[model samples]
Target chain A: MRLLFTVILAASLSLSGCAGTQQKTLYDKLGGEAGVDKIVTHLVQNIGRDQQVFHYFAEANVKRFKKHLAWHLCDISDGPCDYTGDSMKQIHDGMQINERDFNHLVDLLIDAMYKADVSHRVQNQLLARLVPLRQDIIYR
Target chain B: MWKKLCILLPLLAPLSIEAADGKLIATPGVSQIEGAAGGGLVPWAQLAGYASRDEIAVNAFASRGSVDDYSLDVFGAQLNLYDRLELSIAEQEFKVDALNLNIRQRVLGSKLRLYGDIVYSRWPQLSVGLQYKQLDDALVANLLGAEDDSGTDYYIAASKLHLGAIGGLNWLWNVTGRYTEANQIGLLGFGADGEGYEWMLEASTAVLFGRHLAVGVEYRQKPDNLGPKEQDWKSAFVAWMPNKYVNLTAGYIDLGEIAGSDDQDGLYFSIMGTF
Candidate 1:
């Protein structure tokens, strides 16, 4: 059993090693504050037009929504900013956010990133880091 | 027949990754033999696709593997509905170019996600799977003293992902138990040397890297139902899902020996599209 564990450990190292050392925070890859703002702007622009998802944004304050989201992304990506907003559960509690809505938002976000020309690898990295947050934000 | 399927497969697949592309990328591994989402050579309990309970997705894949003198090709398609049930059909061809002999088989499979979401639930995803395998080479089966050329394998699998479990790394572990009498995965025959039913254990473990890539190893225990000695199967693989519609896997597999053949080890490659 110990031998087997060792073998797996070695295999994992071999695969992970090639990731190449770039200690830059996801914040930098996301192009810092300027880059994040552009993505948030595009995202909000789409929310009002998306038929299946626009209804949920009916009462939303587009300005505040964009700001909060930008700060949230910046903070989570290890950017040089802080998100002092309420927890995901508190913010989405009464909203009755369903999976479809959540996925819609995800789509908008990806589009926003693409508009900003964020590299695919960086996009994937950011998304990966944010995915775990779904448990906290969905159907709470 | 293969030519017609080649054209029909794409029309039935690819949902197109519209956004975050969350559900499709690397989360659900590639479809394995007998049709379950998993590593290259072994099936994990993961359902195929990024679709949640409210959605549906379909995919098809082709794999070609060469080990020493033998060439194995497999193709299949699957439908994942509501992230709960998976229905699939696959065909396999084992060719010995040197011997000018080819054996074919068909696999029909189904898996029910009994409980726990692989990604969301705190508990591991557990599923029950059944695969019905039918071989075309009845002559070889009969000569091998096989009781049947077809058999059904029943298995239950449990899988868990320990997110950020080690060194800010994620790892997945899976365990499966199967009851079968198919030797050489039904290529040589079924129910001969050690007939009836035999229980086998399969295990898989992988490390998730770069969010969209995974490296893993699988160990699948096999039943020595037909003589000459049946060794277990093992493979180490790297799987990548670059986007929602494309997934590629490359690996090295040691399929052990088959019917007096030497230990078969070689490169394995598979490409799949999810819709």
Candidate 2:
């Protein structure tokens, strides 16, 4: 009984240590809505510079797209925001998006994150959240 | 060596970093010891190639490592499909001038990436690889007490990239478990009179410097099937990429006493390119 009790105490202590002294949400680390807005704004700008992907956004409503993207990022980061934009499939369907375009967008997004001074941890976290959605965004 | 260098230089000339979107970048982790994908000396969980999830790519490499009494030269080619599977072949010659021993080996390898992405996924990427190693000299195998001149090595590896793990830099960690009897990676043949296949471990960790450079160390456990005291191997290496097409790597290696010789410390140089 005493050994089991000691093991439980050790496990709890390790778990607490892994939880960190202070847990900051990824949303907070990314600096909230204002930060998300800055990243999305720069992301769209970089996308415009990429010739391979630029054509897809050539006729897009920049202001609305930026707003929806910011909210979507916020939603993914566990922030207090709702991504009420069109479904990813609905927006990307019939775009004939290829692997090159998807990777190029990721590169652009990374550039935008850098421009906004987003931490590397936050950048990877965001990329991980978005990478799985490739199934819906590409090859359709 | 010069002839191979001439062939590689021309292929690397036309590729600028930004021009190759559909190509594989010269990431150091893609170069393995047996001329497969992984670290300089140990195979990582990632498959070899610059191919993305939907592309096909081919890569080839030539490398030289020299010690006081020996020099090893390797030339190899690999094909990566959709960044998921890899097939490779290598021919290696170990020339021990002092002992008047020239050993040659032919290695055929294949790797399958089971799941996860090294960079994009939250979980570590895992792969299983098989290598069929055949030695050309039967006299050396018999004299050295080797049970066979040909054997297969099977390994499972897991690699993870931890972004911002070290002072805002990316860190890569890999662990591999191998079942093999090949002595000194089959340069000395397989098995012994007293022993059969043995299990070993290879672990590697690297910290990325920017996007084009990685500095790391690797530790490889070797089976003690040889008569002499052949200890584990360790090395510190740096891999640099000037562009998407070219990769250069150098390492200071300590391969513990082999064939009754004292600790063999050496320098390793490798140049590789993908098309």
Candidate 3:
């Protein structure tokens, strides 16, 4: 009986120990750039069709937005891409964007993330990085 | 047999004690940021994107003064995952009474945080993501115009925990941005035809009174999106945590004013649980 108990304890400790060492990289978990590209593409498409906010991009270049978005996501996730677009504050400086407009964009992005099958953990990880921009995005 | 049972009881007692204390062990894979109740300076949940232990936390709150009227509520949840990365879903309902308008808004949202600890020997914690806010459109529409704003919002947040053991003060500063374009539903009304992008800046600080309690305050400034007019507000609150999974908070909030409307002040309460 004592031997059996000791064996169970040893096994449980070993199993828990193994669980602690599994390291996951964001790039690998997100399936690399291809996965990132899909998410960005879906997000851009949704933004393009949003009648309420689409006008902001009506005169702008869609291709540029797409490229910048991809780069931004890559750089954000600690990927190899470099973001050369305007600083968030500089780009949106004069636009009087509000909470509602901001939230709308968030919804579209969330939908895109869901459709792309981004894991919840990855999504939250990504969000923590983005939450700070509220200062630069909302002009007031 | 009786003597054998007695001998076993001592060993079994330790096992039972551990079983009860097991409840105290933080659930695997989830992380909880140490702070008082209320969303982060950036309007995201306070756990820094991690869920509560056992995928659950319960919070209760009350407040008076500063923002005007008082309010209270409870929040509970289990953090699905809380380790190097975190994902959690929480539900919060606010009973707000001020400006002659008494109403409640039930908000449901999910959050994800990537990377485990923002603070390291060399780097700060950073994350980016979006939140979908589906306001009871019909309910809000009847009460506050055609609720065209029940949509998702995006944000990118960067946080750094300041080393303050020397001063016994804990502080973190975060900046967030939301991309906004005209014609979409917003917190106010439909985006104006010529509306532009909006931004928000938030700063927060906390003072630990003991191992289990802390008081925190935050300030946020945002654009009104009504052309050149800028709107902003400040909030101050206290947070208490009995363990790793639950947090309770209460505070005063001022929502500024609109179209000559008096500034809206009110109390805020929040509860958070992690799995």
Each candidate's fnat:
0.05, 0.17, 0.00
RMSD in Å for model 2: 6.3
The DockQ-derived docking category for candidate 2 is: incorrect
Please provide, for model 2 over A1-140, each residue's C-alpha lDDT reduced to its tens digit, 9 standing for 90 to 100. 23433553465455446536547777887888888888998998898777778999999999889888888888988899878789899999999887756876887887899999996656766766776687789778
Weakest 10 consecutive residues, lDDT, candidate 2 chain B? B19-28
Q: What tens-digit string does per-residue lDDT give for candidate 3 at B1-275?
A: 23432453454343322121111111111211112222433443234312222222322222222343423232323222332232333333333454443222233334445433332213444455554444333343333333245445555555554422212223344454554321112334334444455655555544444334555556666645453343565666666667644456666666566333456667665544332
Model 2 collision count: 1
TM-score of 1: 0.79
lDDT for each candidate structure: 0.78, 0.78, 0.46
True-vs-predicted CA distance for residue B264, candidate 3, Å: 2.5
How many Å off is the CA of B258 in candidate 1? 1.0
Instruction: Candidate 2: give the clashing pairs.
Output: B24-B50
A121: Cα error in model 3, Å: 34
lDDT per residue (tens digit) for residues B1-275 in model 2: 45765786577545434333542233326566586788878988887755677776677888888876778888887778787889998888898888787899999999999997776566898899999999998677778888898999999999988654554456788999999999889988889988988889999877766667877778899998878777898877889887666688998888878788887989988877776
Q: Tell me how candidate 1 scores on lDDT.
A: 0.78
Q: Comparing candidate 2 with candidate 3, which one achieves the higher DockQ? A: 2
For every candidate, the chain B TM-score is 0.93, 0.92, 0.62
In each prediction, how many residue pairs overlap at the backbone (N, C-alpha, C within less than 3 A)?
A: 3, 1, 81
lDDT of 3 by residue, A41-93 (tens): 89888988897578766777878878887788788778877788898888778
Separate DockQ for every predicted complex: 0.16, 0.16, 0.01
